[model samples]
Target: MKGFAMSTVNIYKEFTDQKVTENVKKVSVIIPNYNYSRFLNERIDSIVHQTYPVHELIILDDCSTDDSRMFIAEKIKTIKDIPIRTVFNETNSGLVFSQWQKGLKEVTGDYFWIAEADDSCDPHFLETLMKPFDDEKVVLSYCDAARIDDDNNVIRENCQDLYNMFDSRHWDKAFVTEGSEEIKKYLSVLNTILNVSGVVWKNIPGLHDIFEEAKNFKVAGDWYIYTKVLEKGSLAFSPKCLNYYRKHTDSVTSSVHCDIEYKEIVSIEEMVAQKYELDMETYRWQRIRRSYMDANVSPEVKKKKIAWVIPYPGKGSGGHRTIIQNVNALIRHGYECDIYSEDDHRTTDEQAAQKIDEFYETCAAFVYVGANPRAEYELCFVTGWQTLEMVRKIPAKQYGYFIQDYEPWFFPMGNEYLIIEDSYRRGYSPITIGRWLANKMETEFHTPAQYFDFCADTKIYHPIEEIEKEDAVCYVWQPEKPRRGSELAFRALKILKAVRPQTKIYLYGSAVDAPVPFEAEKLGIISVQECNELYNKCAAGLCMSASNPSRIPFEMMAAGLPVVELYRENNLFDLPEEGVLLAESSPESIAAALLEVLDNKEMASSMRAFGPQFMKDLPLEKGFAQFIRSVDHLVLHTEYEQPKAEQIYTRAPYKAADEFRAQALDILYTDEVSSTDAAPAVPSLPRRALRKLRRIAGRGVRMIRQRIGKQ
Candidate 1:
């Protein structure tokens, strides 16, 4: 039989080689077995008869107590034409570590298919599963599966419920009719579900490490593995049921008979909570446990607590300036505050110390904000570089991310993604300084954010009475970054200088290497005290951005100077009508906008006057209040409890009270609840009636399966 199988394998190889190169056919199926020889032959037969021919089959058996190893060895010997390799594990090392790890190590195929010992696949499973891999973006793929009983009868068809399996915005349309809008929605939803065995990852840089990390996880190992894969690339799903998932009385999933199967189900939730740094709510804990067991917890129980921590910037950078102004305003308005930063080393800066001490009197606490090895805080408020390092270390219920600008660009690419990804994964409520930053957080990072305009000390930034409209002054500290679009401003200013020599361009910030093209005032870098003077002397400020909607427009406006704003066409925020002199990227366009503002004294005057109104309307205090409210709403409305009538009324105050009243009344009258008298009356139905109901259900299932087959 072995000799005959080898001859058959040679013939098939010859036939395949004559027709097509094996390189075009890339998938290999690996089956790892332990014991249970009863199903070994059928599992191998299923693979041999697959419509799509895979490159090879590698079977590794752990020394089984039963004859399963012998049966698999016999099957391999019989299938000589197909390249087959069999290795026997000296001892049973368990399914995940021994059999699966051995297969992972030995398999040389581009993609691997794992067919479990008891589970079998349809003839077309390999062919269908491999189709999605044609697209390079598809790093992982999985097909819908059916739950089969011991006799191979499908107890439930379409058992791969991706929506229920993963906590993602995608999955609602996973099983819609193909090419339809519903199918798109399903794909969108399925994109987020991480199914490890159902997926085939390319031999990328991090694949092995991901698998190893997953093996280390005691529970929710599959989720940990799949999520790592998803972070690297996109996922694809097949609606058709190719694999049959064995549902037995003695299966590992079946053995975990907890109220909520913590070993199996709780891992995903726990992983999600830890990843996002979310406070595990009482209802969420109960719901997770309840999925596996009929366990109950009190609704009134408080599972987690939240604290708001903020890092104070003591220096006079834009971030610190805003924080100081806001803190003072809050303190004056009777809101309790706290201050934390690197220890105040400059005792001579009397003004800074006075402000700090004044704040300290009203603040709940004040301490140096740094890596505190011994201290633990529930939350940390952070700004600038401190946010990148300190925020993650603090195990906080809520994070108040006060983003003043798109600061990530200042860091390297990988570091930028790390900061953004961490914030997004940790579920921080970001309070952004501008609309552009807010939209980027929402669209790119998929994190919820609210926009608040930067606040200035109106007393410091008041209009300069002695200043007169002469020449437009362009002041930028670091004008090298592409996003700043400073080079465009330079070109425009050069043209404007030629057209009007009297115009003086004052360049500030970092300019160590680059030479000034024009005879301009090069104040390499200025102190905070000098920034106001620059604003006071300038007739109009030059502002430009390729990506960010910068604070310069608002800053110049507050200083009673019209702004020549050169921005990208797809600006996320709407520009001010009168105060902003909008310019395109082209030098000609920038010059044109600059000339218009320069030539029209009346328009410039109106813009300068309109600037104060814009500042007044968008005060930081009002914006901060709105930010607090938005955070409150998100925390309150997050899906913790299954919405009760009272919860609905409280959470959704916009809904009419009468609507909730009617709903409450309906719930009270529903048959879902039973009285003590009704409980005694609710006896089991007669045997004949119960049998009749079961027969009807069985008939319905059969009819549905037949209909599906016909379709």
Candidate 2:
């Protein structure tokens, strides 16, 4: 069916001062179509069956050469009741320009929607999309989109984690609240702007001007438009998949040229940067340049254009070692390299200064590795253990959060909000270490990120001693917290101890004086010099995480030791199947996994052989290179990186509370009827007046009935 048309009268103007106006409730859906005749009908049908009735569908057909026009003409005859207006373009016009100029001109309702012809939405899409606009500060609203294949089967899910959208603390708090006020509060803190199809934008001041300026841009138009809108007001987001974004072979998104798109995107982004008064153009350019490097370009050209930056060398934990190895690998390749750390103080008595000095000397470039108030580093590289508070103090062009674990969990409630606020405010771009974290960052924070898995130095972590067939060794870093699966590990060890008393269990990391619950040896924290020795002698490793992926699995694999892993459902990252045992976080499951790994010699040997190869596959050098490349691309593609709103009012946490409340009241009272109403109805008197009138009429009727009885 053809989409709805704009109302004849100026609905917005008529209801501008109508406290409780029906216009506020009405939605104008603008579906722009080119030539996807096959999917256009289904999309229109979905819109027709919407649960919310106060809506008009506006369709713009951009001079399609196919049967799209015929399809629309035939469908419009059948659906006569639904207000559908069809606009045919005389000549071919690009998607962004056509929508910016003609689409805005045709829009007559309170908000405008862009439902592309190939995409479809759930019946409740309008209801959910409109909820955010209840607060006036929420100029734009978006919902998660479900990814569907050609057959309409759900090929993938696009559920957003709240952590990625707001501060970690705010997300945690938002999920725990029972009131709508809490949701509104969190939305104010993390002003996410994107998901255009899932969004409904209020026709506010400067919106038209912003669209007109961006009308001529072919690629990155949506990005530019959203960035501009964010400058004017806050954004609200729904995690629910109200819209379906179809992936087809002939989609414009898939066919666009990288260089051409990059150039246009860069130009627009630079314009935005200047307009917004942001000072992050250099970081933006670097990100864009990396994208060009990854595109179909020559290797020599890429090497010359995009240089790699690595944090200086240091004797760190397994995680830090991986980082150093990765940097070394990139340097080995034909890429320009620079390293930054502290000055040469390795021989000094102070441990921190000595470490910094050693780190600096080993790399190409090195500065002090602390809170640098004056450092002009383009990007601040942060390790998992580093404090986000300290990272915020640094004046870097961009911040790269290299998380090895769910490190934010360590902070007190509301602290993560501060950290995320600082990063975004400073125009930093996040780069996570794994798929799980990357997905979390993208969906929840509304920040784009790349996943660079931990790469191991296979040269250091390898099988040096012969495997003892009779003995199975279990390594425990700590046997305390349940989240670490320590309780389960202890239970499994007890069972294994009873069954195979000779099996040795080695505990590492923390020092414990408690009596042994089972036949296990406790090895307190050891020097780095002795870690490799212990790993080489071990037959297998025990790896576990309550809600996140751990690095121990990869480390064990590198040492040719099969790993018995406790699987948690929330962990969405990928793991190597071979040499890794997946078990539920239970005593029985843990025991079973341990038994399988210890008893099966052939399986153990297979895992031992597979470990080295897996380590080789995820070399630190390759992952680091990929990371550098990703950062480069992001810089190039982004036009202007706007500071996150959270930082603007972070010092006064409740600074926007009054403003938010005021805006909410305006949205609620602006319409002629309750914004929740589905259709037009007769006006009703105040509840108090209606109740009094009904009582008075009942009394008069009662008195007349009594007189009749007396007669």
lDDT of 1 at 620: 53
Give a tens-digit lDDT track for model 2, residues 540-566: 778667545666676678878888776
How big is the positional error of residue 312 in model 1, measured in Å on the Cα after superposition? 11
Model 2 C-alpha RMSD vs. true structure (Å) is: 33.7
- The CA lDDT of each predicted structure is 0.54, 0.55
Instruction: Pick the lDDT winner.
Output: 2
Candidate 2 lands at a TM-score of 0.40
TM-score attained by model 1? 0.40
In candidate 1, which residue ranges exceed 4 Å CA deviation?
Answer: 1-316, 327-369, 373-378, 382-386, 407-415, 418-422, 479-488, 509-514, 523-533, 569-574, 586-588, 627-711
- TM-scores of the candidates are 0.40, 0.40
